[model samples]
Target: MVLLIGSSMFAQSVSAADPSLAELKKVLQSQIELMKPELKGKVKDLSMDTKMSLMAILAMHSRYSERATLRQVMTEVLSDYQSVLAGIMTDNPEHTADSARRLANHRIPVGGLLPYLGMENISDERLAVLDSFNSSVEGNALKLADAAEAGDMVKAASLIGDISSGCVGCHGVFRSQPGVSDLLSLK
Candidate 1:
């Protein structure tokens, strides 16, 4: 198939470029699938050379083991968020706020292929829009903790909503399964 030919050809060049072609493929495929949505059909648009270039960038940027760790980190973070949400519902604002502060204090490893890249694209342009979302999540967590400590239920509830907006923004793109963005293109 065309994919095999492309991959095979790239493999030779990549192998010559470096002896880690197999590892490169593994890392590239996993990461690309992870960010397939954000890439926005960029793969299909790329020349073999460009795709190879992207693959090289990916291979050099983050290791496969590192990605696994990143995934685990996200899993833990989301689990923590669930605990925080539950605490809020049960009138346990102090606990919820404490949980929220965990996220606020953390740098929040991003999801998808660009986990280590920190919201960068192939062009290496910082996705500036995501910065605001990050700030919102961090900022609201602090405010939520403050509101909860003050026993201001109304303000705490409002801050939770604000925090959720940030989560929604990130999860919509990053948490979805591979091929989701190109579902219509799949036969």
Candidate 2:
């Protein structure tokens, strides 16, 4: 597959350098940018695990800053979400549907999202809540795609709000840490 080959080539090219975290992040970002067009073209066909596996390869070979890698993945997801919103605003059903599919299939973080949010202790009850949050977002994203494909713009628009709520609820639960508020306020 192209993804594997790209990662392999990238690994070979960088292996001798012993790149710093910043350099590694930079290379990964560039690689991601290079792949974006190809990704957009085949988002619907891409399995949910594709991006994750690619990132895993990079992480495995590099210093592997989990937060930075997770942030990069989230950045890609944000772009897809923006495209979906733009499509809705412009009444472009095809774009909306495609972007929604991308959103639904965005990669899981290296060890999953909860640990990144500092929810490392993940009891069964916590996991159930996490699963609920994930289902809400993924399910709504799929429904959004269906609505857009069916030309039901109104329903698609409503699903966007539901998806946002799901994301916000999950963040509120996991990311509302003590330093987060201070960090957000910029001291």
Candidate 3:
């Protein structure tokens, strides 16, 4: 009887400690969702140049060689991106501002594409476009972030719409890449 009781207790503890895959996915999805309002607004109003720059950054970050699988690349990218965003949201104003500026520059390297695609090069045209987009949108995104941080959800919502429009404009101009499409597809 004691053995059975101990086994049951062990099973309960294990179950509590190990979240199900669905639960894990939901947590991740929620985190992504939390940033959506800001992202959508900024994307909508982003200049073509800024959009192109962001696309290039994402492309560069998503690149992978034979060593890493697509899933691995995506996981790492998302994790890193989330960390960056969290830092922006929680850090001191000066640090957040500096980090925001750095991201705005789009100079940070995020390694290669997904492993399945092997080694691939980023196109000059794409990079140029992204540079333009980043320059145009970064300021607005920062502004929205500031408002959101201040608890002004109304301003944040308006800005989020603007961002979404910028994104739509870019998608209209350029063929939507699979990754871009998937990112935007989130409700």
Return the top candidate by TM-score.
2
Deviation from native of the Cα of residue 74 in model 2, angstroms: 1.9
What are the per-residue Cα lDDT tens digits for candidate 3 across 1-187? 0000111222333443455523323332332343334333433443444433443344322122323333443444344334445554564444433443333333221121211111121233433443444433444556655765675545644554454455455445442233322222223
Better of 2 and 3 by lDDT: 2
For candidate 3, the TM-score is 0.31
Candidate 1 regions exceeding 4 Å error are 1-68, 107-126, 173-187
Error (Å) of candidate 1 at residue 171 is 3.0
Model 2 lDDT-worst window of ten: 178-187
Alpha carbon deviation, residue 3, candidate 1 (Å): 33
List the candidates ranked by TM-score, beginning with the highest: 2, 1, 3
**Candidate numbers sorted by lDDT from highest down:** 2, 1, 3
CA lDDT of each candidate? Answer: 0.51, 0.56, 0.36
| lDDT for position 1 in model 1 | 2
Per-residue lDDT tens digits of candidate 1, residues 21-44? Answer: 766555544444444354535444
Tens digits of per-residue lDDT for model 2, 77-154? 689889999999999999999998887777644333333444242233333455456557767888999999999999
